[model samples]
Target: MKRRNFLSLGSALAGSALYAGAMPGAAAAGRDRLRIGMIGTGMRGQVLLRELVRRDDVEVAALCDIEPIMLGRAVQMVTAAGKPAPATFGENGDGYAYRRMLDSGKLDGVIIATPWEWHAQMAIDAMQAKVPVGCEVVAGVSLQDHWNVLDAQLKTGTPYMLLENVCYRRDVLAVLRMVRSGLFGELVHLQGGYQHDLRAVKFNSGDPTKPYGGGVEFGAKGWSEARWRTEHSVRRNGELYPSHGIGPCAMYTNINRGNRFTRINAFASKAAGLHDYVVRNGGEDHPNARTRFQLGDIVTTTLACDNGETIILQHDTSLPRPYSLGFRVQGTRGLWMDLNRSVHVEGISKPHEWDDARVWFEKYDHPLWRKYGEQAAGAGHGGMDFFVIHAFIEALKENAPMPIDIYDAITWSAITPLSEQSIALGFHTLDFPDFTGGKWRTRKPIFAFDDRY
Candidate 1:
């Protein structure tokens, strides 16, 4: 039934009576069936949609996108999956269509994969409507938006997750198990970053005729376009996309639980990569050719945790570099380095030498992967996406708190804006906000590698 007609019927037959009949209990929620709505039918959204509907327990009840083509494709995918075609809202002028779906009372939750700017607002609105939200990464673009999301989650007590797939990576999770088991010893320092080259994607004047395409070359595509990401290259100076690297590091370091970031200082290399690319390809007369990108080719952010450990975060996408999270976990006993896929355990190995960590990865393979890795291998991003979605759905069906909760989402995303402020001010040490308000000190870790899972 449509929400409007349902509301009318409820008004005709007493409000409380209707609501009581419609709302389900914890027992019902735990029954494995979860009806969900998806917002933003872009490539990322479509990829997740394919993963989500693969489960018999999940139903894509609704879809929202600005473009009809994208919305139609999603509808077809759902119907092709032997599920009923989902209701769709494609009016892109304003995002009231998203709000309408939230108010419809048909969804158990919503998955948001909209562009970076819309992430905070969409998740906030879903939580405000008393619906759980599983959103894509970079929780917010600005620091205030980060606080906005935190406030909304706190105010509503609704489940909010960042959907950081990297945390579920097989190797990363294996390393996580080692960290928890004292294989890494007392965690002393760590480093990670989003260092993948996105120049082609950032500069790809997206085709406008196809679904998720429709942006003028070298111009902002209103709100939804490849220009949105590229525009960040022209304006921001800090870790623009930090979650991919920071999420796993935060998990391994027990951030927002036992350890909290206290302060940060950042430095940026000169902005040359993007401009140089534009000039080398498109002449000096091109719009981006002469434009001075505020974002440096390489931005390095150093953070100090309240527990006295240090973290180094690097953003090096604009330049020519191979994809690497650069995940480095160091402790009193040993270290795990992603670049070399090696580990150095003090007593287990020769003095001051690194040994292949592949052995440890195999021996300490995370329980989740040991069981489901073969199954998860079918999904995208080397199967990391599968585990991320699986974790969220499992938590939701069981009515447990999200594995990557609101505090983790906000804390990791806030690094971007904080780093920007630090870099702009001559690398001044900026104090990090305690979003947990000291609860981190007492809150036990919820994201642990369980053999039972």
Candidate 2:
């Protein structure tokens, strides 16, 4: 249990803890290999498991899923990796088995990667049990859910991290470095969105024998992992997936630091894209065609921050479009745009023009990326996924503060329910819930941009 260098575990485990000091049990398990439990081994869960299984100092001690097939697949994966087959839990109705797994008293932490609805409850249970949690992004289904998760972490003093891998993207981190260095002086506004073409993914039910979106399906059954996601689209209207856009932007603009989102006004375009796609592929009489989806093909959300900055976020996925987050960070001195890969800085470039962003990327790429870029590139989502998982593992090994703490998780996830309320009230201004409880005013930024191991 002696304190040891986290990097000594391995290169994959090597990374900065950012904030120093260990969590409640860091020293107790310092020498012992970290034992992590996996919850919800669906599509995304499997991807994370694969990355985790590749690590040497970590052990996938347990796996949980409602679906027996998914759980078996994950178990098979652990065995295939020539590692010990992890203990398995599945489908005891009403999440009973998941809670039982938590009570097993066998995990340093549990990673929740289930459908959207399950994240809040699972995280609450884990923290209450004095176990740290690393949950996948998008906090929960509603603003209140975010508050509950936030309250749990605060009350229990347990660490909770939102797995926002996009924040680890090389370019995004580079942008963060510049933001912190005053390269983008006096941050005035920021914009980003989840603009992927999810037409097929939203409709896919994971039934390989049954074609979905007129093609072979993959992963879990019923419409995109438990049918919850499609139901979310059918029932709600707002920025359903906001973290991918707001996560990195929040860091760049220093949310929970000097800046906090104060008010939000959102508008949703008419919902037509999903219905049209369903009819085109499955005919007008198809079940999905008859379902009236409230979610818009395009949702524009505007957020006002306490630091005199405004953020514009968009949710565009139901319609045909190429994948792009449409990340844009602007300030008095310079601006960056992701789609075109361009950047412009006052006094550093021609007047009112953009130079290739690659120039800046090559020159000012984040030190983490510069060192681990090749390894990360071999992982998912252009290597952002690798760093995110790596950072989480290291945090557990060191028992240090989480990279994406509960405050960031709730703030980014709360946007969904807040936007829904705003849209329902005809784009009326709604105050953002202060999950930090005013600590943002004095709390030092926990996310460090310094280069280190």
Candidate 3:
């Protein structure tokens, strides 16, 4: 049932008034089943689907994607677990299948893995419909998608969360505990980076054999070949794809906590050896081939928060660099960096200490993760995906604030587009709009809801 219908049903049961406590049957049948639908289930969609299926309290009531191929695997995933076959639909016929399904079903919430451009549009529609939303990547395509979610959430009174999964990393969570305990003191500045090479993970026109046709998160029959990057590239020049690289640190510094971003400047390098390598590696006759990459090889951005704290962000897609996201946080007392898959803390008479991500989990001799962590670990990003979704589901069941709340999302996602615009305007300082209207000042911390601590 819709939120309105649910509310009215409660009113009818209790004649003229309602109490802080629940009515008879209302308390018996709790909100155990949350009717949910998913949009954009490509690779990332599959990751979230695995997480959603684990909980007995929720079910994937509906599934929508642009291609039947994408939905097939997701369908098999949920059903193979003994759940009934969901009411499945595909926009393979049209790109708007997600919208049509939203109108037809009674969805309590939605998990959108749709492309960056559509992030704001679909999420806004879900919020307007009074459906809680958990979305991936970009907060808004332009100013409109950004402000629309803010207004819609306020007007309709629904939860709008950005599905930034990194905040749930076990090591990151342990780091938060350390920070909360003041192990990392008065963080003054930090650095974040998302560097990956997809040269082997070819896109539509990007491959020589044309193995897979163009159809991504925002699927459509003929979605202009050049439309790819607009949906994917996190940093045009030096914008931080904070969801992955900067996400954990945003939590550490309390981005939406008390300190927030004020302005940023992005500087990108010109075409490098890799650009020429990709070109020379391919013959001149590669049709519809890449001309000049807008997101040059490497990009660097510098941000200063309201508290006079600074953060350095770096982005790169070329070169055979190691697979890693550079994370560094510096404080008045000490500094922390994870460079070689090991965190190093220093700034003392003696170097603080260095520990691998495993060290934190080692002490988890406590079995919170052992029973639940195995299969999710078998799935994606060493199971961080499950951690994020688990946090979201528990929040709904308990009426607690979201771990990655709307403000957290807006603060992190805002960096992408603004960084692009900053590079476009030649590093001129651009204002980072606070979509929260400043309510972040007093809002409770969302992650504290975790009972595991």
Task: Give candidate 3's TM-score.
Answer: 0.82
lDDT of 2 by residue, 91-143 (tens): 55345688878899998888999988889999999999988899998888877
lDDT computed for candidate 1: 0.80
lDDT of 3: 0.63
Report lDDT per candidate: 0.80, 0.80, 0.63
- TM-score between candidate 1 and the true structure: 0.90
RMSD (Å) of each candidate, 1 decimal: 10.4, 6.1, 8.8
Clashes of each: 1, 1, 0
Expressed as tens digits, the lDDT of each residue in 1-453 for candidate 1 is 221232232224321210011224644668568999999987789889988888898989999988776788888889899999998886565666899999998888899998898999999999999889999998998899999999999999898978999988889888876876677677788999989886766765456443232322444632234556778877789988888888888876667765688998899999888777778776777665677789999899998987777999899988888899999999888999999989999899889888998998999887778788787877999998888888777667867667788998999999999999998899899999999998877554444555322
Give stretches of model 1 more than 4 Å off.
Answer: 1-29, 208-216, 221-225, 451-453
Model 2 weakest 10-residue run by lDDT: 1-10
